[model samples]
Target chain A: METVLRDAAAASRGAPLRALTVRVGPLSGVVVDSLRFAFESLAPGGPAEGARLVVEETKPAFRCPDCGTLYETPVGDYHCPACDSVRGELVAGNEMELLSIEV
Target chain B: MCESCGCGETNPHLHEHGHGHDHAHGHDHGHDHGHGHVIPVRSSALALNQRLADQNRGWFRAKGWTVYNLLSSPGSGKTALLERTLAAVPGSAALVGDLQTERDADRLRASGAPAVQITTGETCHLDAHMVAHALDKLPADGIRRLFIENVGNLVCPASFDLGEKVRVVLLSVTEGEDKPLKYPVIFREADLVLVTKTDLAAAVGFDRDAALANIRQVAPRAAILDVSAKTGAGLDAWYRWIEAPAS
Candidate 1:
């Protein structure tokens, strides 16, 4: 929970960290459940001890470069439904970001 | 769940037997609880690594070096290819990554090029920070070409940026033709796709056409090269691609 301690500068050093929320994108290659498991197993004896870990999944979003069509993959459908664009820029779903911490 | 902390507790972040506190950041003014607070971080987990990677990219560019990040499965002949490349090309250096041991680095150094080994312990992929640290250990200067042989994995290395001028993904002929389709993340990031072990293609019943088609399907933009490091068959073309600057 080094990230939690670093970001929890507002709280006292020994303040009991209550929770942690993180944003996980689809293309980030991180499993949400596994992340929670790791956090739970590692949080003890630290500032974030007994902290509840919350992981929010981001929908895989893609922006068509040619037709400017925005698409989301909730069902593993990556191709643009609006336009058949081969080169779609990833607008989201490629990040593993820490959102906030409560202490 | 409470909106502040996503904790089911009615008064989330509120301390039991609360006391008036002089905490840092002063962001606890609005909430019912005065002592507890939720700080918004809003930063990537890999922020430090990404920043270091950008710095490495800048430094390599300043030195006019063409660095290639080589990725493949274990036993895909990445070291063999590098051994040949270091022997074939002049002013080239390498950084080989492995879970343990410095054998790959020793083999590369024996190829008559300066090579450094980065033992990652238990890490599956080589992050930018590790490369920056290992770059310090490498002593050779005026390195025209720098090859960073990433840990032999198809999955994890795709997400880490190593500040390479280009990424070369190797798919050995012994590995099935559908590997590109299976590991699309790494295949899609390829600037060059090298089909290694061509000398054993026939003996291994490797379908060259199907493999080329699969590579084209996943990485249409990457320049495909069929190279047999054992026979030195396609080494000339790979060397040419190295010498020719990015277009």
Candidate 2:
């Protein structure tokens, strides 16, 4: 993570880099709150440190077999709202994407 | 760490296979190993893929192409359906995903439909990132319909979103009608359901009503179509529904 930040800084050619925002999907296996905490802890006193960190938590998508409603599933618990099934389709959730590093 | 079992900590085998005790015949351990170190992987490996999927979704929307993801079990006629569809609708492109063979792409290409094969290296499902890579490699230029035929696995593919507008889960009539109820998640997530191999319906004793009921039970709002790629029976309805403006 630190190495990627340094590369981003170098690529910017010393221009001030702003917040590093990322999208964390539930199925992506990455915890959003924890990642944000780690970022704040790791980004201090570094070349790309001190910049604001933003982590966007993406809800895991679920589709109810009974209703076919495509909606987000809650973390840790795999339950379908429309059908009340413990199991359903996890359409999208697992994702940790570096959207962009704004300079 | 035990070379035979990969048990770094407790010897679970010792309790079962210890000494003269018939149940413990094979058990032998030198010391009481401590608990295994649990590493919390707080990072999502799919983040990069999801971002690319979002970008792909945006690209598809911008280009006004209706992206359809076709998923089914192997030999369920997903490629054959696409091949038939290409014959019906000219100028449509497809990105086919498979574990090994490029035979599907070759068949589609023979039908005058430009198709690309994405062979996943032992991966069960095709993720959004893979789809993005395949799209770049395939070059969907001047294409109206974009079909992403996912790897032939009903289980894993239901978990990943490949930035498609519609998820079409096909079930061949030859396959049991109870499949939808058994694999409810895939059926539930599908926006449309295509019941293939209708020509063999009677020969295989495939109950059409029971299958439709099972589908409705799993996905109440999904549009169900029974199509025979062999006879082209009900193919026009399938085509019109897919090409319809409302969809």
DockQ of each: 0.37, 0.04
Runs of candidate 2 exceeding 4 Å displacement: A1-103, B1-46, B245-247
Model 1 over residues A13-40: C-alpha lDDT tens digits?
Answer: 5666777778888677676777777777
Cα lDDT over the full model 1: 0.78
Off by over 4 Å in 1: A1-14, A73-85, B1-38, B245-247
Model 2 chain B weakest lDDT span, ten residues long: B15-24
Which digits, one per residue and each the tens of the lDDT, describe model 1 over residues B1-247? 0122343242222222112234365443443465546666666766655666787898899888889999999999999999999998999999999999999999999998889998888889998767876777766576889999999999889888888889999999999898887877777658899999999999989999999988877665689999999999999999999898352
Model 2: per-residue Cα lDDT over A1-103, one tens digit each: 5433543444344545565556666455444676767777777765447666666777768777767777775544455666667446666665565544554
**What's every prediction's RMSD, in angstroms?**
8.9, 17.0
TM-score of chain B of each: 0.84, 0.80
Q: What is the TM-score of chain A alone in each candidate?
A: 0.82, 0.62
Q: What is the C-alpha lDDT of each candidate?
A: 0.78, 0.70
